[model samples]
Target: MPDNFNFEAAPFDTLSEYERNLLRSALSVGYYVPGETLIEPGSTTLALYIVLKGVVEERGKDDQLFAHYGPDDLFDVRGLFAGQTRHAYRAVEESIVYELNAKMFHELCERNAPFASYFQASLAAKRQLARRDGQNLAEFILTRIAREHLLPAVEVSADLSLGEAARTQLEVGADALLVRLEGGFEGLGIVTRTDLMAAHFQRRLSDDTPVGTLAHQPLAVVELGDFLFDAMILMTRQRIERVVVRQGSQPVGLLHLTQVLSLFSTHSHVLALRIARAETLDELQRAAETLDTLIATLEGNGIRLRFIMQLVSALNEQLLARVFEQSVPAAFRSRCCLVVMGSEGRGEQLLKTDQDNALIHADDISSEDALTWMAHFNEALKGFGYPQCPGGVMASNALWCKSVSEWRHELQTAAQEGRPEQLLRLSILMDAYPVAGNEHWFSSIQAQLSTWSDQGERWLSDMALAALQFDTPLTLFGGLKTSGERLDIKRGGLFPIVHGARILALRKGLMVRGTLARLQVLGKHGVLDQHMADNLAETFELFVQLRLSQQLAGDRSGLRQGLDVSRLSRAERDLLRFSLHVVKKFKQTLGRQFHLDTR
Candidate 1:
């Protein structure tokens, strides 16, 4: 075994000292020269090779490259299990590898469950394990309340004097005291030291005043087993300093905002708070630019794409609202509503893509005034790192920003005409989510559109038919099919699922904007089977994660150039294949439901 073999990487990291010794005992170093074949196709498998240095390539017949293996990369586990090589492995350059004896490898697998499962687990499971195996010092979202050090709540009777409660708080070094509610009330209430000070100074309350009058109720609380991230959201939303940690009805302790923030100091909520506090465009721009860095940090800390999206979505909305409030005149802003469309509206945006937003103003508002306000709003966002839509689908476009009646007329006309462009616009508009101003204006227009969709099956079919625009990027025998070695993930995987989900949601008149949420609602209402819905949701999440990985690696082409297939790991490639198959299945289901062929 080489002295520098990375025991901290992958399945090795899951091993115990006994298993490490077994691996070391059975490991032998092997060296290969450039163009030299390490394993010939169809030959009986020998040892498992982990690259120690240089490069190795896995090639199919005619020397077609599938993937490249570098230092710390393990190869041919499938071959070792099956006892035959499906692909030939050759050294791309001078290479050194540590070959573990096959018998010893199997013995280690038999001895260890996690080690064995790493070889046989599904792609999703493999990804999760791989993340867990990485640097986990920043992974705090899964931290349960019981796992962290919490402040003890000094429980006091409601009838206790304020001075005594204040004395007890000081003696116990507690910032807040829990008060048991009187008059047969079952829940607890809370009074902070600030409350005591305010009562003493502002109200000139007597020291003998009952703490019950000072305690705020009903108290905001989180369960003992709740994820700390959710607790943070609760506190942030409620604008509180602390929440009582409870096990069912019994109070356990107090978790403060400061305590949660200490672990999640660089978390998304911090960015949201920054955006919320920014009163100027320059201030907002400075905060918005760091969002990409934040995304990378969160991903590095092993956060899942769905949660990342959720947090980013909320932050982006806050940033947009701030932009609108600052850039638009207060008088004019009251007469209109601002909305984000497409992926942004769906709350599925991971990286900052193009601006797909619009304005819906009151019919009586002057168009000239509204246009001036929206132009500044759009430019403010562009300065804040949101790129303008290449298709001009932003609020600045006259076609998108319009009065209520104008929006209604245009939507009705589009529904009646059903042109390709009109269909595209309609699909985009279906996912519109109000970010600022009069949400009622956006809802009224959206409700009318839904009613229009209900009036005709032909229009709904036309919309659903667009979902099948691209073929799944898969070969007849289940291998990946790519253009110039790149797979357009948005076209092949994301579009089909998103559009299909949208069409179904529209058909049922469900106002939900998210693709996964729509699928859940559809499944719940029997429009889609629960099993299929769950599969599609998982598949969609995998596709989004894949795209985000590419984006994080500086492939900012986003929905344009697609994912570079050659850059994917074996597990990622397998997941991509599986997800594409799900897209195919989902498209077929949509086609059957919409009667596309008859059209």
Candidate 2:
């Protein structure tokens, strides 16, 4: 075996010393020129092919490109046991592959459970391996604050002169200095270069001027045990560039925003800062446009999709809140609450989709003024690249933007009528997450959803039926069914999970918005078996990730629901099949639970 071969990747990483030796003893290298066929379709897969050099193209029927493999990429493992290759492998360039003997590979699989499981595992197990495969960034994102290069605390006495503090900062090359206060101060104070510059401009920094006087107390601090990501969020939210790192009450070091940015190789903090500092519609719009860039950077860094969604959601909510604060009058703003519905409301939305928002104002407010403000807000979002919701789910719609009493009455009417349109609106509103203003009004409305579910089995059945409306995109023999070489991932995978989880949570009267959170709560309370809940959660994540990858690959106009099957790798195809099966099983569960057929 060549020492150059990467045993650190995936299934190879799980092999034991004995198993590795067994593999090494039987491994043989093969080379092929460009256009040479390595494995012909319908031929027996003699050995598992691991690409050691150059590119190998895996083509299906009609010579259509399925996927290509390069150095360190392996292929045809699924065919090894099946005894024949379903697709043809042609060398796109001069390629060298380390072929492992099929008989020895079978022996290794029999002896090593972990190694074999990678070739034949459920979506959940495969996902776990994928995470392990991405350990560098996966582990990087979960890195603790203490592990990063935190600046050591440069502390000065309360009586230290501004000139002396400046000297100390220069001597240590520190951006800020911590001041130890006298007279029973609760925490240490902080003074930055900005403060020194301000003091210099004011001519207030005499040699006798005390640094403590300029220092601000009650410093923002994070524990050493907290994740570096959490520290970044703290800095973003607090609008601070640096935070004091404390172990218990003792200040140990300072974590600057730059440190966090350096670690992730992303400007997510800078993006957040831009959004935070934006005071005009045009400024916010510019900031909103760069979100795709930030998301791409994060995704490319191998950060978990869930984390990317969460970070994007936070930035989005902030953008909305900023718009709200700027557009609405102070008096009216205090009287109304702004909410986002659908994907945005659930915090699972990655790239920008159509606007799904509503407004709820105090009944005493001027209706005309409220409507005008909401219309402006909607237009502002449109200007910011959030296309108007085709179904009129935005706050600009008078039906959606209503008073507390009016919304309650409207919901009750929907429940009573049990009409399809009304039920759809109810589901959309059910996902409402308050982004700005007095949230109590939104909560008052949200609290009534459980009671509305009690409008009897008829209402519940109607709501649950939507989950089963779309058929799973699978053939009779369990193969993936595609149209125009693209599958409606939203309809086939995402909708069933989202709607199923939504209906299930509603039935149990749980108020959580995100699909994963709803499943978690459901699982914990015995509504769904823990394992099934976990499977559903993972399946939902897989679908969202797939949809997001598709969205990111193309124009960022809106949700890209169609997944091009030819673009998927063999492993991805397997996972998709498994995930779809999980969806089918979940739909069956929902069917039985809600008695969908009878409806």
- Residue 259, candidate 2: alpha-carbon lDDT: 82
Tens digits of per-residue lDDT, candidate 1, 110-134, equal 9988888878865555556556622
Candidate 2, clashing residue pairs? none
Give the poorly placed runs of model 1, Cα more than 4 Å off: 1-111, 115-123, 133-139, 147-224, 234-254, 332-334, 405-419, 445-453, 556-560, 597-599
lDDT of each: 0.82, 0.83
Residue 551 displacement in candidate 1 (angstroms): 2.2
Lowest lDDT 10-residue stretch of candidate 2 = 129-138
Please report the candidate that would top lDDT against the real structure.
2
User: 126, model 2: CA deviation in Å?
Assistant: 1.0
Model 2 / residue 442 / CA error / Å: 2.3
